[model samples]
Target: MDLANSGLSGEAVYKSTCIACHGGDGKGAFPGTPDFTKSKGPLSKNDAELLSNMINGFQSPGSPMAMPPRGGNVSLTDADLKAVLGYMRTTFEK
Candidate 1:
């Protein structure tokens, strides 16, 4: 989805891609995955930091479950990633 220009919003992108691992509530589907509802979770990071981690794939120290590069969807563009993150921030950061 060309989210920057396409009518799709951040919530749509997140549902289409991120819901698998992150869950609809952003609580994460499996162990080691971060819980966005928490104050100290990914919501604490800035866009740049989050984007960089997703683009490069994050493997936190002592963690076995890694989030693959582009969150396993290589077709996603930078704008798509940003959109998904925006959804996460607004929906789960409370």
Candidate 2:
């Protein structure tokens, strides 16, 4: 899978990158990490906004925690991050 291109498998990308902070259930690893499974969370943002945050990194406006650029995996492409976000929306944002 060429993660640099379009190998945007949500589950795979989540496992390799996001799971550490976001957790397997998308509940987040710590206080500042947004609970994707929760109704009022990152899912509130649109895809473009979310993608931009994932790529550029995001610091919590109300908290000290932040998601580093590319979730700190730098190796992941925009598509990869998009897929992960899409997957999160589909699976957890309900």
Candidate 3:
């Protein structure tokens, strides 16, 4: 799992890093995960905002997990984040 250089595909990265919480189908887990499929109004938020949140993290006043800074994998590059976001947008946000 050479995430640093294997140039893992978005789907691969998602499966390896995101599926644990976001779920294999991007439906998200219980306890507090946001269900992207059911997102109302506009799931397409500002890319920069999403990127910042992805890289830094989002607490949302009382979020318990704190989003784990880069979703818990600091090795992810900007491109990887963008790809994951794209994957989510294409797959989950119906």
Candidate 4:
């Protein structure tokens, strides 16, 4: 996807890389994936914590699988992660 030069918007990144599990509406598609609409859900975490998890990968308490580093797209930069994070917060947080 040439992410190195694409400068993709957060929504684009989310659609291309995050939608499969996170879903179009931010509701998780998997058995234990987090629901972004909930006030106390994963979005409640601060950016630093969320970024760290995204960079290093994280498995929620009951999630069936761990989110791979950079949502499985290792080419994504810190800026991209932050952008996607912001997008999620804006688009899904209640």
Best by TM-score: 4
Tell me how many residue pairs clash in candidate 4: 0
Once model 3 is optimally superposed onto the true structure by TM-score, how far is the C-alpha of residue 37 displaced, in angstroms?
0.8
- Measured against the true structure, the TM-scores of the candidates, in listed sequence, are 0.85, 0.87, 0.78, 0.91
Question: In what order do the candidates fall by TM-score, top score first?
Answer: 4, 2, 1, 3
Q: Is candidate 1 or candidate 3 better by lDDT?
A: 1
* Worst window of 10 by summed lDDT in candidate 3: 1-10
* Clash pairs, model 4 backbone: none
lDDT for 69 in candidate 1 is 90
- State the local distance difference test value for candidate 3: 0.69
Ranking 1 against 2 by TM-score, winner: 2
Give one digit per residue, the lDDT tens place, for model 1 in 1-94. 2346534567877888788988988998877778889998888988889989978899865567888998898888778787787778879997
- Per-candidate clashes come to 0, 0, 0, 0
lDDT of 4 by residue, 1-94 (tens): 1224436778988999999999999989878988988999999999899989999999999888999999999889887888888889989998
lDDT per residue (tens digit) for residues 1-94 in model 3: 1224435567766887878877876656655665667666124576677768888877644335667777899898877877777767777777
Task: Judge candidate 4 against the unseen true structure and give its global Cα lDDT, from 0 to 1.
Answer: 0.87
